[model samples]
Target: MMLHTALNWRYATKRMNGRRVPDATLERILDAAHLAPSSYGLQPYSIVVVDTPELRERCQPAMYHQPQVVEGSHLLVFATWESIGNAEVDQLMALIAEERGVEPASLESYRHTIAETVARLSTPEARHQWAARQAYLAMGMVLTAAAMERVDATPMEGFDPAALDEVLGLPERGLRSAVVVTLGYRDLETDWLAGLKKVRWPRDRVIVRAE
Candidate 1:
């Protein structure tokens, strides 16, 4: 019920106070995102933490000059790998073996399964789309974690991706921005949304249970 309350209290904060989120609290939120599940447990996304004002200032134009982009304490850019093939599968298998204390050879069949899925994509675009979906799973975790921590978070997809990619040097890193979220404390005095009620589709209309 604590999570329920947190979700109810949180909103897509439009204005921020520029108060920095504590490092420990930020880490806990990031840790939750890291632990989010992905296909075959092969997480294909990376989070770029942008906490410096200068950097956020540079990112402002890319985000269409959203005030929160600069006023927020930090930005979390979730990016998907530009490629995911056999090599990525191999790395996942190796990490799994190391973490579970098993032989890499024992994971051969599982590795093949992951590789086969990647091979089935047939095109770079398809692979990128698949990876982007994985990135959004992590995004959900990030929003929930921020809510639980009582940190204002605003997930955004209003940016020019190509411009943002260039600004952040994402192509060189083999990543492309999938989504961005800004974190900070909401400004109660001036934010119009602060006093409004949270609106959503009623549960009965949104949820459908089928036999």
Candidate 2:
């Protein structure tokens, strides 16, 4: 019934009542994100959880003054590595090789192939964009996990990335904020979307099959 639970639980939460989400629930959401798939098994993203009132308050301006930024019990900021360098690729390959008991030389060759793939990227921006796309996959997983736990969430894309990066000290880690989600209990009174019916494209129109 896991799939049924997932399907029955998902919703784009509109408002949060500021009730604290338990650490256990939060960790479950993160575990779901950790299990998300990524390209080449190279997970190039990290989650930044902001639980402090002061930090969330400071983030409001960066989030275009979205009240949820300050009202939600927690802010999950998804960020991706700024650049894919040789050292990072080498590290991943080395782990894969060791786990598989492969020769270092063979691993080196594989690393070269990965490097070539990265080099073929049109620019650093393209590479970062690709990584950000992976981050979005993880974001989707976390959002669904939150919904499954009966937690409210708001996926936000309107924000000053530069300001958030500076505030979160992401540049120091060679990462940049790609997206954000606020999670907590919903404030039904103020959440206009809470009572509205959700609308989506018909399955026939959105999905195509070739036989």
Per lDDT, the best of the predicted structures is: 1
RMSDs, each prediction? 1.0, 1.8
lDDT of 1 at 199: 98
lDDT of each: 0.91, 0.84
Residue 1 of model 2: what lDDT?
83
lDDT of 2 at 60: 84
Top-scoring candidate (TM-score): 1
lDDT of 1: 0.91
Record all residue pairs in model 2 with backbone atoms less than 3 Å apart, i.e. clashing.
none
Q: What is the Cα-based TM-score of model 2? A: 0.91
**Candidate 1 per-residue C-alpha lDDT over 104-183 given as tens digits, one digit per residue, 9 for 90 to 100:** 99998998888899899888688778988988888888899999999999999999999999999999999989899999
* Runs in model 2 lying further than 4 Å from the true structure: 1-5
Error of 2 at 198 (Å): 1.0
Provide the global lDDT of candidate 2 against the true structure.
0.84
Q: What does candidate 2's lDDT look like per residue over 34-145, in tens digits?
A: 9999887778888989999999998888998888877788999998887786777888988987899987688776688778777776576887788889999998888788
